[model samples]
Target: MITLSGNTIYLRALEPEDLDFIYTIENNESVWEVSNTQTPYSRFLIRQYLKNAHQDIYEAKQLRLAICQQETGETIGLIDIFDFDPKNNRAGVGLVIGSQSHRNKGIGSEALALVIQYSFQQLQLHQLYANIGSDNEISLQLFTKFGFQKIGIKKDWNRVNNVYKDELLYQLIQ
Candidate 1:
């Protein structure tokens, strides 16, 4: 099993025990805009998803990892590689720190660094990209800090609250 350790945080594989934590994050309406989540997720659906979490990334075409605090072993966030295209050697990345209390801490940054290293070094991926809403300045900054460059933008890409917002495309070529 892969365990990415940082000074203050670590990334680990998702487990059945993460059901409740994932449920809370998935159903949180406040964070839906960034995730493009329009409907609430039921516990039953999440439970089924958890059962399939063991599938290898190459077979599943996606991977979601739990972000944990180093000393206390508390799961504070999730980092995902979605829309993985092994043939193309690329994938889309997404991340979320479940609560506002975890925001602005170095946890997210460290988790992202570990994921990038794994994607490029272990997975032998050529590049990683992120689709970020224009209003998500924090995420944009976090990704950009890791050398992800703005590649393009989709105008009116996501609709939130009654208005459409632009989505920025960022890419990091390894």
Candidate 2:
């Protein structure tokens, strides 16, 4: 398992014990916009997914890591490397802090730094990208703080509450 630790938080591979946390976050309608969740997930389905959570990222083509507090070992958020393309040495990054209380803290920043370091150094990736909704200023700021430049925009990319929203593509090239 890969564990990347920081001063306040650490990123670790998913475990069977995280089923409830994953299920709750996946089904949270308030966050569905960013997560692209269409419907609630059943516990059975989540259990099945957790059973295979240990698969290698090379085989799974994506990796979802839990962001936990270093002191309490409580999961506060998740960071994912999706749409992995090893041949191109690039992947899309997705992150969520799970609740409003967790937002605006330094947790996401620390986790992002750890993930970027792991992606570039351990995974040997050349670049990493993030797709953030135009209205999500906090996330845009977070990625930009790490030198992820705004590469392009997908006009009216995501639909939320029956309205279309633009999605910005930010990239960090190593």
Candidate 3:
């Protein structure tokens, strides 16, 4: 398992033991709304997703991490480095704070910073991109705060709550 540490937060690989925490967050409607994931996630589905991720990890195709509080050691969120392009040294990033109590605590930013450093330094990735829903102001602001530029927008990219919504694409070139 990969581990990253920061002043206020830390990240480690999501293990089978963390599945319950993941389920709690994945099933939350508020988390799914901004994350473009379906709510009321079942254990079977999460297990399937984890199985796929485990396979990818074995193949060295992806890096999926669980974000947690350094002091409490509580699993609060997840981060992924996906869509890896080795030739271009780039990858796509996604993050979700599953625990409502952890929201707006600077933990997410800390985790993002640590992961970006890992992606660029350890993984030798030259760039990273994040795609967020247009209406997700907090996520947009968070990424922007990390120097991610608004590259473009995809119209009607996601169908949420029975309505089409735009997706804002942001990129960070290291």
Top candidate, metric lDDT: 1
Model 1, 28-54: lDDT tens per residue?
999899788989999999999999999
What's each prediction's TM-score? 0.97, 0.97, 0.88
lDDT of 2 at 19: 90
Residue range with the least summed lDDT across 10 consecutive positions in model 2: 1-10
Give me the runs in candidate 2 sitting further than 4 Å from their true place. Answer: 1-3
Which is the winner by TM-score between candidate 1 and candidate 3? 1
How do these models rank on lDDT, best leading?
A: 1, 2, 3
The C-alpha lDDT values of all candidates are: 0.93, 0.92, 0.83
On a 0 to 100 scale, what is the lDDT of residue 5 in model 3? 90
Candidate 2 local lDDT, 1-174, one digit each (tens) = 344899988998899899989998999998898888889999999999888888888988899999998899999999999988999999999899988887888999999999999999999999999999999998999999999999999999999999999999999999
Collision count of model 2:
0
Clashing pairs in 3: none
Report how far off residue 87 is in candidate 3 (Å).
2.2
